[model samples]
Target: MPTTSSARLAALTVAAVCSAASTVVLSAPAHAQSVRVHDIQGTTRISPYAGRQVADVTGIVTGVRSYGSSKGFWMQDPSPDADPATSEGVFVFTSSAPKAAVGDAVTVSGTVTEYVPGGTSSGNQSLTEITRPKVTVVSSGNPVPAAVTVDAASVPGRYAPDGDSAANGSVNGLPLRPDRYALDFYESLEGMNVRVADVRVVGATDPYTELWVTVKPDENRNRRGGTVYGSYAAQNTGRLQIQSLGRAADFPEANVGDTLAGATAGPLDYNQYGGYTLVARELGALESGGLHRETTRAQLRGELAVATYNVENLDPSDDTFAAHAEAIVRHLSSPDIVSLEEIQDNSGATDDGTVAADETVGRLIDAIVAAGGPRYDWRGVDPADKTDGGEPGGNIRQVFLFNPGRVSFTDRPGGDATTATGVTEVRGKAALTVSPGRVDPADPAWANSRKPLAGEFVFRGRTVVVVANHFNSKGGDQGLTSQYQPPARGSETQRHLQAKAVNTFVRQILDVQKNADVVVLGDINDFEFSTTTRILEGDGELWSAVKSLPRSERYSYVYQGNSQALDQILVSPSIRRGDGVEYDSVHLNAEFHDQISDHDPQVLRFRP
Candidate 1:
């Protein structure tokens, strides 16, 4: 979700201080010194003096956040303590525009508090801050503290230590080794000035004015200059989030593999979004990585073309219809059949009783024709009211659109919005008893999720089976930037079952017809290398078409510094072993800020 306008305003103040060269003197009452910022922010995650009132805490104003709930300025001690475990800088929460300017030496009196941005229930770590501050500026025009270098060599080789039980996620209560663990590295430099040089962009720049970069490119590196997210064990410690504090002008429009010419200098901050962020004021120029939005693949003669795309909650009210249609017609070469996900009901997100998506699909098909493409016919069962979970009342479900001139859908009897379709053998060939039917609709794995839409098509007198799916998303899972070490992926369990359900249904069809041209594709919500995909492709029953591409080019989605495959097109043995089968992930959306959706559409071309 995007940050609120008020929060962005607060971040802008911090960015202003980062770019500020001089500070002006202001008349204010002076107070006697008592404690240092290092003492307020101890080695531990929580503040030692939390809930206690402290008098005359002395430090220089480094940066200020003038909006949001915890609006305040960061203060740093000019003379630091000998202990390397403690941070010299601390945030003063004023909850409004601060009176102190950058580089001002001042004394502050306030109550030390530990603030969790998303509240206590979120399981996120808290930031130590001084609230309700009484500030008195004693001097101005003082030089700010120099930033510490944080390169690959400065970062620790390991991320976190293992624990015996699930409760103990990582080794805690240890001394801060900024050079050892990535979490400790960020914690030690919390609220302090830091610099990362010659970094490569691993994550695309987001609309929230932030991007992630990889400082240790030599370790766990991809050919595109990104840090590959291999699995739970090899968490990439080199990746770091870069935030301009909502400074739109300072933020660059960058994609993965892009490089920064010079060093990015800023203060280290811990937030709810991505654990540790470098709120930089001065970022180097962005250099191109020779990456471009890919064009449509050449259409093969006498081959059936199919595609899978997540249109990102398309409804009657969305104005992205024309752009999406253009992408399908021009960039996708107008595939013979297209599998789509997230097609909302007629009323979109309104909590009305409207459940039909006729208006939505009609508008999209009309736009495709208007874009000089083939007129398409669509088929899908409207999900039961309020059963398929996705934006409330959106009634998001999978739908198939086929060119009537080239392919015809074999619609049979006994399919409904709720009933599951059974596999049956007809004249010694496996087929769906009810074409355009739901796959295991009542399965527990599909509860509150979109069920797979199965459709049998006859193109050029050859039978083709396509299953459109949108599995449960990866929500409620611990992020890589979480304080917990080896973050838990609790969401993958449901997806595993969902994959198994689809695989079993496909096996039923392949059982009777050994050479069936079955294609299972859509947003599985897991990586190509994930356990979910592994379960779907068990024992080569289904082969992921994405693996046909090179390692660096097998991505259809970019998330958190990893260009991984979330949207995939997996084919059966017949399609995998057949000649002249080509696959390409048309990378027009995922790598750009003006993307219509978070996922890129994937196409599979083959002669059945």
Candidate 2:
């Protein structure tokens, strides 16, 4: 392997002059062809292949020690297409070239000498390279400034990135290959350029931006300690072409001087650490540079609240709400009342009572009874027939359940009692007038997808409106492939319309709120960081429960290591009356623990 032109020039001069003395070319021209890189193939063994000069010797650098004081013994690259061996190579490193990035690509011209696994007792001809190997630094193609390199400690995948830290015979562990292929390579970045979320963001070298990309391992492989590679290190630099977004222009918020991409022609292959992982077989920098903004601040409280949870999808036999009914019952003990989401509808043979999705409500009712809380019942759901029925085991998601002991019900403006007809509107959102005639569940289904159930609940002689909401998921119009027929982010216009409707509904809720005491609960499907939450929380309305904490401590639950704030509680100013309401989160199953529901039942307290 030859290093950069300047590096090899010095080495070549030494080789030429030293050739005449005892140093032979071993050029059996035909045999030499075997070392022609492209001609070399098959497993690379130091023994049988001894004295056999092979080209393209690519293998893991199990042992990286500066041999004798002047040189070091390391393995050669087994070629991009070849397999890395457990321990190959007895090459000599001559401090030649300014230190080679270990997990780098090396082309060595060598004569192998067999050495025992750990070296023989008598020091037999363990494989050894007579000539010092030259090298070429590969690039990850990440545009980085010369001032900074990647932070190796946070590297997500395996690889001893430090040029000084030497390994004897094995490398570090690797990542569980992403559902999609992934990897981390090294690159000698030139300037200040870096790619973010597929988009290449440029830099002016003014306000340095350091970016640390992280990909955590699953339970099977516990490689902990934030695998977020640093600003720009050999371990952090690499040109990965895994369907990455290219160009500063291609990506929104992208800056100046960003490299489009210098990625490999195709997808990354599974690097052999233990299993599959995406990493750079070889990588480097693209110039420009990096950025890293560690924000510890939490999102401030907002007026509108939204949340999501798996709840294991409550069913007839499953009393999710009822089983956890204690939490809600205690919630009502506060100044404001709470809204229910994911209330299952009876989904069996309706007339005869064959347990179906609609029948799930029984679980809640039963649980409530066992707890002996005020007779709280649900309203505002779909008519048994209209709730996407037709084919089989019913899976209806209704929103009902109220506590009569806490607040009195009031029809919104004007409304006849609801029916079991299965029309889009089940009982229409039931209203519970809080103290002084304030609605606990404030706004009704104003627009789109079975809008939230709203009403009033009385607390401390003061009436407060409560609005329960469950919005669409940002997993991005998935069901669209089938049910929606046309994906919204795609061609279908209505899906987009539906999305707008959801947004509009949120707007309406904020608009009609009578006081700052409006508390919004229930699952809102959207996360705080997303556009949905932002749009819904509109203009200093609802106060957020989670955002009030610091960012690192903000997440309520984690999925695949990505901590997200899905289940949320937002209180209006009225609860605080200017001071903001008191709050706490019930994360029994969310500290990386699995529980009754995917979403935690959040709670808020106020003095009303």
**What residue runs in model 1 are displaced by over 4 Å at the alpha carbon?**
1-33, 163-167, 170-172, 217-226, 287-290
The regions of model 2 sitting more than 4 angstroms off are 1-310, 319-336, 348-359, 371-375, 383-395, 398-400, 412-450, 476-516, 576-580, 592-594
How far does residue 53 in candidate 2 sit from its true spot (Å)? 28
| Candidate 1 lDDT tens digits, 1-608 | 44443454344233212221211112232333367788877876655676667889988877766655547788888899888778988878776679898889999997776665444444455667777679999999898888778888888888865432555663334556765677777787888878898898888787777788888887666665666665666677888888764456567889877988798976787776677878775687899897666667756657899999999999999999999999999999999999999999999999897889999999999999999999999999999989889999999999999999889999997778888888888887778988889998999999899999999999887889999999999888876665455667888999999999999988988888988999999999998889999999987879999888876677787787777788899999999999898999898887775788889999999998
lDDT of 2 by residue, 1-608 (tens): 33122222223223211333312232232243234221221222222344454544444332233211223434333333332222222344354432544454445555432222111221111222424344444532322211112222223343322211232221122211211111212211100122223223211111111111222222111111112211112121222221111221222222122332333111111111111111222222333323221111121323222222335345554535654654444422322234555554454323443423434655655665667655555445443333332223432343535445544444443221232111112134322322112121122332223344455444435545555555544433321101111212321232234334434433444445435255666555555564555545556565566566544444444332233566677666555465544455554443211145555556554455
Please tell me which predicted candidate would have the highest TM-score against the true structure: 1
lDDT of each: 0.81, 0.35
- Superposed on all Cα atoms, model 1 deviates from the true structure by an RMSD in Å of 5.8
